[model samples]
Structures are given as C-alpha cells and as structure tokens.
Target: MAIVKLSTTERRRLSVFFTCLGLAIVAWIFTTLSSPLPFIINEALVYKNSPQKKAFHPLQADTIKITIQGTGWQMLFSKMKPDSKPITVDLTPLESRNYVVLSSQLKLINAKRDANQQITAIDPDTLYFDFTNRLTKKVPVRALLGIDYQKQFAISGNVSIKPAYVTVSGPADRLQKIDEWKTDSIKASNVNESIATRINLQPVTEGNLTIYPKSVQVNIPVDEFTEKTLDIPVKLINNHNYDNVKVFPQKVKVTFTTSLSRYKDMSDDLFEATADLDLWRDHGYSTLPVQLTRFPPFCKIVKVSPANIDFIIKK
Candidate 1:
C-alpha cells in the first residue's frame, strides 16, 4: 500500500488533539475512583441451610431490622439484596438479653469494593419480644332471642343452648372478654310450636380471641300446651234514638296461649265489641247500631262470630 505523508501543521494539530483526549480520559477515571459506593438500610440478609436450632418459632414475627454503611451516593441508589430464605432467630434457643449473630447475616455488594463499608446494629444486640402463653378456659354462653316481639305476640320455646359452656383461649386480656360472648338476636314472632335453630356467635370485642367451637345449637319451646280465655264485656255503640234495640251476644271470649305469669295480668276489658251505626243510617233506619268500642292492648282480634246485629226501632 502507498502511504501519504502529512505536512508539519497537520501533524501538530493532530498531536494537540491526542493530548487533550488523553487528559480527558485520565480526569474521568480519577472522578470515578473518588466516588463512594452505595449502602442499604433496613435490608435483610437471609441465610439458608441454617441449622434447625436457629430456626424461628412459628408464632414469632418474621421480619428483622438492619442498617448498613456505605458511600452517600451508593447508599442512596443501591438496593439491599436478601437471600431467598428468611433471616430468622430462634426464640426458643435465645437466652434472656442474649442474641446470636450469624456470619451470613450481612452481605456487601462487593466485600473488596470498599474496606470502609460495614454492617452495624442500630438497636441492642438482642431483640426482646413478649410472647403470650396459650391457655384454655371454659366460659358460660348465653342466648338472646326475640325479646322485642309485638305486644300481641309472645316468645316461647326452650331457648336453651347445648354445651352451655364453651372453651376459649388467647392472650389474657382477650380471654377476659369471653364471659361477655353471646349469640345474635333471634325471632319468635307468632310462634305456635316448638323451634330449634343453629345460631352464629356474636362478634368478639377483643383481638386475638379464638373460640374452640364456632357454632351453638339453640332450642326454643313454643308451647301450644296451655290456653286461656279472657271474658271481655261488650260495649254498645251510640244509643241516641234507639229505645228498643238490644244486642244478641253481650260478651266476647278472647283466647290466647301464654304462661301463667302473663295470664294473670290479663283483664276482661281487653276486647272492644261495637256495632256500626253508619250502616243503619245508610239503610234509612231511624235507630243506631252497636259496635266494638275498646280492646286490651295486649289482645289481638281473631274473629267476630256475629259480625252484625239488627237494631229494632218502634214508631
């Protein structure tokens, strides 16, 4: 190949360009070397293949806190890398105020990268955790059924619970709320026969509370066994112009099945029987009609045998 020779000016210009390039390369290298490496904070360094003796208990918290030291820029940008397995400390093996440090607890980006970079413990060497001891206690269970039924309707049935007592366990403070445990409200509206149902336990007021048996069976007795009658005096409607009107049935019988305690409070004035005088007026009759005036608040109307009776008017 034939070579072309450059003039003096061209060679000098080329030399100057090469010198500047070399200086720039050296400066870049110096800046890079002066920069600090990154550090990670609260990063976990997990170690696998740890001995069984070092395994943490199932009830213990799984996370650990750690602090690492490195260059400001490196620490700001670099992320902490942890092993696949968890870094655990065995609570069973630990003595009071004593902790075990694993060689693999902390890892650096490159051990040789910077000799100044280090791992340190921000808190005490050992962590203290208050673990609760599991305990079981039997507590009485109560059932709260329909106690707010309408006045006419009454609640009946066993309303009893199976395994009246339940076994509950948890932290001491949690177990204290067990005595207040109860079932949700149940309805016994217009019930005529016995009843049985499965009810869920009410929400617990405290955390960490656990009940051994989830559900309770409730038995209610809607006793159709005893029935009683209340004789209510019949009242006559407006008797303004009727000088010769009389009602065939002067009294009525109000029947209900209720316990003796509630029956005694029953009264004869609990029923109101009245004859409609508007119907007589509409039919061009000069006499007034009888009607049911008043009834007991606790009594319900079942049937009026003779709904209407004739009012005789003499001219």
Candidate 2:
C-alpha cells in the first residue's frame, strides 16, 4: 500500500475546524452547569425507621417533606414510588422545646431491590422535608349518610353509632375541641330503600385535626307507604237454605275502610247478614231450620238495621 500526506493548506483547514468544535463543546458544558432548574416538594422523606416509635396519624405533619428537583416538565410528569408513605417524628425529642421543632435532616429514595441483587438508580435522589411533632386526642365519631329525599318521609335505625367515638391527632389549636364531630344532615325524603353512604370528617373549629376514620359508613332505613282501596263483598246468612224464603234488601249495606298494608290478603266475600229462621219454625213446622252463618276472617258485619226479619212459610 502507498501512503500520501495532506498539503499544508489542507492541514491548516482541518486544524481550524477542530478548534471551533472544541470551543463549542466548552460553551455547552458551562451553560448546562450554570443554569438551575425549577422543582417542587412532592412528598416527605424519612431517614430512620424509628423517627417516631409511636404510630403516626393521617393529615398530620410528621418527620419529612419530599422536595423534588427537576425542570417543570420533568417534575410534572415524575411520580414517587409507594405514592403514600408514613413519615414519623419523635415527640419526646422535642419535649424540652416550648414550641415544636422541625428537623433539617433529609433522606434520598432509591430504587427497590428484587431477589437478584442489582444497583438501580431512582430519579431525584435527594428529597427535602419539614417535620413537626403532632398531639393526639380522642374525638367522637359521627355517623353520616349522604342522601337527599323528598319530604314526608323519615330515616330510622342506628341514628347513634355503636362505638360512637374516634381519635384525632394534629396541631394543638385544632385538637382543643376534639371531643365531638358532627356530619351533614341526610335528607329523609330521598330515601326509598336502605342505603350506605360516605361522609367527610369536618372539625367543629377550623383546625388541623386528623380523624382516625376519615369516613364512616351510615346505615339509613327508608320508609315507604302505598295507598290502596279494598272492596269487601256483602254476604247473606243462610244463603243456601233460603229455598223459597226471600230476603228483603239482599245485601247488607257495609262501608268501611282498611289499611293498604293488609288490604291485599282480604276478599269481598268476608261480610254477611241473615234473618232468624227460628221465629218462622216456632210459628209453624216446615223444612229444616237455619241460622246466621259464620263471618269471614278480619271482617265486621256493619249496621244490620233490621237484623231479624219474618219469613213466611209456604204450605
């Protein structure tokens, strides 16, 4: 193979191109390092497992605050693992201080390891958080059912809770009046059938108190009524044995009212009236003797003005 060398002019041109490229790379590096990106605190980070030995309550500011550093676009799209993690702080440590003290320490979140040990990097390694010890107090649990109905109806059953109480933990101002909690009124008219509804736990005074059971299950009994009319049949006593004997006013006038609840099981043939045939047989002998028949169930024979009537015997 034969080798050829470039001319002096060609070498100089290549040198100039390389110098410009090197300068551009330096400028890019400087710009990237000098500029700071915007970020947001998405959650709190807890460094030690024993930040607070006691259980932590919800909505209570504790051992950590999660600070995320990134461009607006990246922060908006980024998310934290285990979306919700309990951050604890030791209240005993801050007991000496008159006011609550916040710790300046922070922890970085790392990628979780699987059965196969491997190093994984989680984005936004370091996180900043604010910590304050919260006071816990007992509060009454109020049952709430979020339902609205028309008027003329009411709800029944378990208006008061069985274990009608709960515990709350938060700022001192909010925990002062943590004895009771009331829920919004549940409309009765809206109730058609039994229902289970959710209600928010609101503080009587605007404070940072966190309820143990944030929500409660309310059991409401709905009342329903229907209107109906029943037609009861007017019956005649001794109807079969009447043979030649006639009844003046065949139907015994009966007009009464009953409730719709029991009306369905009732029939019209439940009422009847009859004449005393013993009077006729006493006067003279004839066919078999007859008396008033039995009445139907749940029925009354209304106003038999002339209950007894004379029956003429046919020779």
Clashes of each: 21, 10
Q: Worst lDDT window (10 residues) for model 2?
A: 110-119
TM-score per candidate: 0.31, 0.33
Q: Give the candidate number with the greatest TM-score.
A: 2
- Candidate 1 residue lDDT tens string, 210-260: 565767888865433335666655565555766565655555555655544
Q: Please give, for residues 178-199, the per-residue lDDT of candidate 2 as tens digits.
A: 5677666554545556666665
- Per-prediction CA RMSD (Å): 17.7, 20.2
Model 2 pairs in collision:
43-66, 44-65, 44-66, 65-129, 148-190, 149-189, 149-190, 150-189, 150-190, 233-268
Query: Whole-model lDDT for model 2 versus the true structure?
Result: 0.45
How far in Å is the alpha carbon of 294 misplaced in model 1?
32
| Cα shift from native, residue 152, model 2 (Å) | 6.6
